[model samples]
Target: MVGMTEINVREFRDYAAGLAQQAASLILTKRAEITATDDIRSHSQTKTSAVDPVTEVDTAAEAFIVDSIHRDRPDDGIIGEEGADIPSKSGVSWVIDPIDGTVNFMYGLGEYAVSIGAMVDGQYVAGVVINVVKQTLYSAAVGHGATVTYRDGTSTILRCRQETDPQLSLIATGFGYTQTRRSGQAKILQEVLPQVRDIRRMGSAALDMCRVAEGTVDAYYEHGVKIWDVAAGIVIAREAGAQVRVPEVWEKNSARGTLVWAASAELAPAFERLLSSVGANGEID
Candidate 1:
């Protein structure tokens, strides 16, 4: 039998929550700094494609989180969007997305977040996602349920809507960075739009999943999302009673794979069928 660490899920969750909030605060400060200095345009750099961007804040925030993890959990591994890779010796690895929705952040659209997830032996167990501009936080620990906390200290237990009909359920989705992938996603959306109550194209996948958890949207699905993009949101959504369909390989290039989320188990099959019908399962480009 494999040895399991004597870990406290709640404690781990608390730490992740603190880390996420700290990173988000750092990002918010940096954004303010940019605005104050009128230097927003100079801080961004494109990655993979011109549409995909990484801001200086992204790197700085990630560095702050990485430094914290190194200081607090020396034995745990880290995988971050800004290229942090540390080997795990304690069987726990932390996934970090210092800023999800960089485009939104760049444009001051207010949908970005700091997402952090913890995995033990490759299985996600705890997560924290903080919407920095909105001061909203969603968190979950395995078997401990999920909750959303606001800036005023008010908190609510997350619960997904139980809409049984696909036609009446509202779904959220996002497009990938590459033009070819965007074209394929657009085609899929054309078929899915009329069937659902409506669709929301929220730029951030992490926030989209959190919206599902909070019943703001009935479901969410996407393609080509990185591990850091959905890791934290996945745990929060699942803990809120949503069903998540992750690809077999978490690290696979989702440009050729898919990630799906639904608010209710009863509505998931219908949504899956709709996606299948539109050939949304096929690789983009």
Candidate 2:
């Protein structure tokens, strides 16, 4: 990767946001076509586990994004969930999740999103996530604060709740695809549930991170999510004033068997202590 002294993070953020918006349109168009093509479901497959579905739309979207990035910035690398990987020549790389919640998308849920994050030398510089069905967008740059836009074109600066008490804080989380892994996740949830206000099993990790950013949820913690699943969301949540510590986007499989959490600064300490108490602060599966 080529090293450069200065990088335009905001511009990169905008480009990623634009890509997410375009991909959202593509996903919506595919959804519309799915209604007419009943056999398409048969063509879909799973990854990592039986329940981790991957439709043609996901691959197509990733190809579209990879091609777009190649055309616009040939020297930049790309790492996509659909197995799009290219080496970086410009010290910049993109991490992308074409469809963050395939199960939710197939089930007609509104929690799925297209997530993109740009990094320089393995550090996040900018990120964007667009909720396809809801037409909501979240974006952030390293120095620029995060923001969320709604379907109505209205936008708001994102910020997690200040001084959100650990006991009263509502937490969001997700389960793994494999039965064995999910069983392990359940054990963590069992220990964490009674400590927070409640738990929400959102279908999308990207959107769940944005929920934490916008204060819709006080915290989010999960394990076994790939870099594409949380790269964009991590930047958004951190820029929105949420405390976060997770693996680098370029770290291969670093998130697997490791706990990742984001909470308000006020709640992070106690929440982390709680996680340690429950044996969630380290590798569990």
Number of the top lDDT candidate: 2
> How much is the lDDT of residue 162 in candidate 2?
75
Single out the weakest 10-residue window by summed lDDT for candidate 1: 1-10
lDDT tens digits, residues 147-260, model 2? 998989899999998754778989999988777668888998998898889999879999999999999998999887788988999889999998887854336644356778
RMSD of each: 1.8, 1.8
Worst 10 residues of 2 by lDDT: 247-256
Off by over 4 Å in 2: 1-7, 248-255
Give the TM-score comparing model 1 with the true structure, all chains together.
0.95
Q: How many residue pairs clash in each candidate?
A: 1, 0
